[model samples]
Target: MNQPNTPTRVRAVLADDERLMREQLRSRLTEVWPDLDIVAEAKNGLEAVELVREHRPDLVFLDIRMPGLTGVDAARQIAQLPEDDSWLVPEIVFITAYDQYAVEAFEQGVADYVLKPAERERLLVTVQRIKKRLAQRQDGASVPDVAEPAGAPLQQLLHKLSGQLNPGAKPNYLQWIQATVGQAIQMIPVEDVLFFISDEKYTRVQTARIEALIRKPIKELVDELDPSLFWQIHRSTLVNARAIDGITRDFRGRQMVGVKSLSEKLEVSRSYTHLFKGM
Candidate 1:
């Protein structure tokens, strides 16, 4: 007879600048999830990112406002991390002490939000929702490198919170990109660009007339550019929605995107295939 599979224990990382807040949150979590293993704790957002990268925990509870990198910034970095068999992205829960103005920005269902000095009733509800999501992921783990959908809602929520944190400051999306050509710097209007492909060091900007390179990475550009105008087709590539000519399938059944006035084709990463669903 075959042996039954063992249940995987959920692990988590807790990040809060205040020791007392971290302790209180940990205590409450223990009450709700007795079997949960909190593998690590961090005192700041930078530490939180490092811990998460090292532990690859099943969940993370991050205090929204931390010194240096804010929780939102850290979450952006975490979301951009490369996923593999050993490290599937963990579910994130934002812990905030802000008033209703800030709390209202969190989108329902993308992830849970907990107020400071968490009440048992509210925390339990969040716990139950997370449990259901974990159960679903467990069932789906049989697929090799399962492609999780882009967390667009979460990204938008984060963007809103960023403004809330800054109070008077508003986010301005990118309008122009400065790329260095052979001998001079050229300012390219965002709409005129065909697509952006990036490597570790530089991003190549392609336009109908000329191609140039910039030092910005795709991860940073995703936050600055208007999501509706430029869609992220792959981890390393972002294509202009207006410049897309058509999408075709390759022999391996991967979706390839073609740009207007450009022969180069961009492959849509599995995580971003939903962008082409309607087409």
Candidate 2:
């Protein structure tokens, strides 16, 4: 009698900002692909990148919009890793709620994405495709380079998003912010703001004179603010470009941004490091 050949085991990582979503995805994956081993789970994009570097999983499912670093930003950094790194670049699968990026996702042929609340049938299809690709790699067959066609569509999508956020028809940037100061409502000039940090509920507005809180989150404010005047140094942090005195390096060699006349320093994550590339 011939011995049976065991199926290949696939290692994977899942990154999502929501714990429930991660659990749901893991549960679904387990039902559809039992051989797929989920080695780790991340709650944010930064954690996702770190987990990928640590685990070197065969595949990673990243949520498109995560706090600290967006999934696209994380994927870009992973793709740019040095060739000599010990771990192979894992196949990426973006999990997003928006359908607008479908065209761009298709252009990046290397990636296979699933929409949020991943349907079992759709995930089964993705799993099959991933398995095929992995088999090809193991057989020493040439895998199509998905990264090659990714650049143009990614750039186009970014340009379109930027234009949509700040259209020429709405050239006026938000000049004043209405925030609660103690019991009274105060209107602060946008220029006076040093930075804006968002939490689950509200955004902290920091200025030279006072600190205030608002119900608006960073996502909403980004569309209203002037991109040239304000730079998104991190997913949750928006710094006034004019207020940026300089960027310094911490002991870990990570970039720390200093705002003019402000005591606090903003730590720049890997995703937004490009904004201060030349500096």
Candidate 3:
């Protein structure tokens, strides 16, 4: 017996600070995708995140420059959100003004982007791409054309976009650390550090030859270090990517990262496991 497949009902959430921009995007989206259900709207990134958590929309259109928690930040948080039904993660489409550099960065990533003052032609292209991705998921097949490839994770793309928007935000990452070794403060070259494990009080900085203690926590270090160089495997641990020896699974089948020149393996928290998806 043959049965016709029902069309998938696509739901979406829109986030933008300007009312006019939101309306414009909504109207255009409706024109391009009349069947798309605009489940909710948000005025800022924070609100967008909350809306996503509530509605679990299939798509999210986020404005890059928001008051607090820029679109990139919101996307990072959304990516780490708990996934249950295998549908919690929605396809993200960034909304931004026309910036040559920003657009160039977007082209290198898997996610699509719409310029401010949305154009019908461009929106149509984005709509088509989104439809393809959603259809692939529904069919229980891999996204042949849009899957995250090497150097194209959402986090990496967000990092590039954030850098483009805030050029001087972090010109140079921490190159050296002042850590206490008994009575003396040692100048530990950041490259020498294998991993950082932080507790309530101090963070332990380990290297092949020596270990030291620093007051800076892993959170602060994450912001101060170049993300391309250091990968945050867990909330309390950040390991240098270049220093990674390999990856292995523990007894519980949890992913663990092995550091070069280090015997102890660091566990990758469930939230940050996407960073090692190659495994």
Candidate 4:
């Protein structure tokens, strides 16, 4: 038996880069609302835009990351539909691995966002929320307004990001160490160290002392250091973020960046090139 002319039923579109997420959501949606029609599925945010424009589904489930545009970025774009109330704006539900972005998405007027590997019970709740909104729509009501900006709370969440330096941990942050230059030994600050150069036998800390012998290998030191401050430029070299002063293009269109403390240039390998762009 079928419910005929159920104009109030929620028709939806689904978008995610992962096939498993799409399939799982499809099955879950069927379990929750057997009558709900999923009109289309998109592989990426760009395609999601095209699909929404063409199919005009009543709802969409979008992923945060894909090959091209991100779901959050895409949602901001779709929310810009013509101001005239020619057609009701479709409801949206975001699915993401990162919980930190939930505040931003919620602020952007998405009805609800769910973390991936969604439990069936939670999915039903979201469906119920949608139903409640639509019931009001059938009678005549405005959608729920977004909660107040969570910018302050977001700062705490964003602080979970990696590469924080804890100077008090074990050994002192190794500020000043002795290095042998020519015939004399000189003291140097760890901050002044441009890079650590490693060899088969030992590692040299290239501070203003010209190059000091470090007790720890470059590999071991990288593990202990804050990753944001120091980058492993090569298997043999670890560079300080502050030490880099300028960049240059080689004849081959590759890059070689120079450090402030030393005359020697550092090679930017393809794998590590993105670090320079971020800088």
- Candidates ranked by TM-score, best first? 1, 3, 2, 4
lDDT of 1 by residue, 1-279 (tens): 532232368899999999999999999988987878999999999999999999988889988899999987787777676766455567778888876523443332345678999778888977765765566455442122122332443455566667677879866899999999989999999999999999889999999999999999988998998766787777788888889999888897778999999888998765455455545
Question: Candidate 2 at residue 169, lDDT?
Answer: 46
How do the residues 41-87 of candidate 4 rate in per-residue lDDT, one tens digit apiece? 99998999888887776778888666787675456455434323344
| Cα-based TM-score, every candidate | 0.74, 0.51, 0.66, 0.47
Off by over 4 Å in 3: 1-13, 26-40, 45-60, 67-69, 73-92, 99-112, 117-147, 152-156, 167-170, 181-184, 199-202, 270-274, 277-279
Candidate 2 residue lDDT tens string, 196-276: 988779899999889899999776676677766787666678889889999888897778899888889997654345355
Stretches of candidate 4 above 4 Å error?
1-7, 83-86, 103-110, 143-279
Candidate 3 whole-model C-alpha lDDT, 0 to 1 = 0.77
Pairs in steric clash, model 1: none
Query: What lDDT, from 0 to 1, does candidate 4 have?
Result: 0.62
Model 2 pairs in collision: none
lDDT of each model, Cα atoms only? 0.77, 0.72, 0.77, 0.62
- Return the TM-score for candidate 3, rounded to 2 decimals: 0.66
Candidate 2, residue 260: lDDT: 86
Q: Deviation in angstroms for 76 in model 4? A: 1.4
Better of 3 and 4 by lDDT: 3
Please give the distance, in angstroms, between residue 146's alpha carbon in candidate 2 and its true position after superposition: 13
Which is the winner by lDDT between candidate 2 and candidate 3?
Answer: 3
